[model samples]
Target: MMGVVYTTFMDMVAERFSEDVLDEVLDDPGLSTGGAFTSVGYYGHTDMIKLVVRLSQITKLPVDTLIEAFGEHLFGVLVGKYPTLAEGRSSSMELLEVVDTAIHVEVLKLYPNAELPEFRCERLEPSVLHMEYRSKRPFSRLALGLIQGCAKHYGETLEISHESFDSEEQYETHFTIKRIQ
Candidate 1:
């Protein structure tokens, strides 16, 4: 994971929870980074997982929920940091369909060491999008939250359906998004 992710997560926690809770979570001995993170650095992916787990314990919210909320919050940070990516995109679906081909490509250029999820997308109908998300790490809720955030950002509403599966060999999720006017 990149430090930008950790920094956004820290910002989200501090805004939603207390700054003290963020401090306490970072203060835990298990984190190798000691909770000090910079947006331009790289950190172990496990560090983020540990922090989210600790935050979940403190807030009594599910870890997945926290991750999803963080994803929603992270989208705003991403837009603020990378406005060119959003420029010329008129709708949420327009932005989402190009995530793998455009946004992730730009992301890799900026943060070469970053590990990102794979999103296979298909436009099944004029207003419907079918997508499959695959990642070694489990963060489907986060992806869903991102999808919701994008729709909100574009001033659109969607009916989203999804399924998740985890086996020894793989973790995969399928999402069906239908734009609603």
Candidate 2:
């Protein structure tokens, strides 16, 4: 996983909870990096899972809830760091449609080793998008949060329904997103 993910998660913990809570989460003896992460470095995905588990224990929040919230926070951080990703995109669906082709391509240019999810999208209607998300990691809830964040960024309201499938090889999810008038 990218270190920027860890750094942003840590920042989210601090901002949404408190610096003290962040300190507690980092103090977990199970973390390989000891919660020290740099934006340009890479770390094990297990370390991230451990951090989220620890935070969930400390905050009494469900792991899925925390991951989803982190995803939303991550969207903001990414947008702030790479404004070009959202540049000239007037709608969430517009931005999401190019994620696999444009955004991930740019991400790969910077970090070829970064493992990103694959997305296939179809326009079901002018106000509706059908998307399939596939990844080795189990983060479909996180993807939902990212979609929500995207909608919020565009000042749009969306009705999103998700169906998921999990297999030994990968996790797959289908999302139906409809813009609310």
Candidate 3:
């Protein structure tokens, strides 16, 4: 995983919880980096899992809920860092349609080794989008949250539903997003 993800997660922890809580979350002896992450340094994906699990335990929130919330926070962080990703995009579907093709392409230019989830999107109707997400990591809920964040960013309301398939090799999810208002 990219270091920016880990760093952004840590930043979200500090901002949503507290500096002291962030310290507590980072005190895990099992963390390979000792909770020290840099935006330009790579780390194991398991490290992020451990941190999120720890945060869930401390906050009494479900792991999925925490991960989804983190994804929403991450979207904001990414947009703040790279404004062009959302620039000239008129709607959530418009932005999402190019995530894999344009946005991830830019990301790969910066970090060639970054492993990003694949998104296959199609417009089912003028107000509806069908998207399939495939990833080695089980983060469909995170993707959902990111989608929600994108809709919110565009001041749009969406009704989203998903079905997931999990296997030893990968996780796949099909999402249907409809503009409700």
The lDDT per prediction is 0.88, 0.90, 0.90
Kindly report which residue pairs in candidate 2 clash with one another. Answer: none
Cα lDDT tens digits for candidate 2, 38-148: 988999888888989999999999999999888888888899989987898888989999999899899899889998999999999999999999999888888998998
Displacement of the residue 118 alpha carbon in candidate 3, Å? 0.8
Per-residue accuracy of model 3 over 53-151 as CA lDDT, tens digit each: 999889899998999888888888889989987899998989999999999999899788998999999999999999999999888988998998888
Off by over 4 Å in 2: none
Q: How far off is model 1, as Cα RMSD?
A: 1.2
TM-score of each candidate structure, all chains considered together: 0.94, 0.96, 0.96
Please tell me which model should have the higher lDDT, number 1 or number 3.
3
Instruction: Report residue 72 deviation for candidate 3 (angstroms).
Output: 0.9
As for lDDT, the candidate ahead, 1 or 2, is 2
lDDT for position 29 in model 2: 88
Candidate 1 off by > 4 Å:
none
Candidate 3: residue 169 Cα off by (Å): 1.0
Candidate 1 C-alpha lDDT tens digits along 57-174: 9989999888878888888788888999888999989999999889999998987777888899999998999999998888788888898888888889999999997777667999
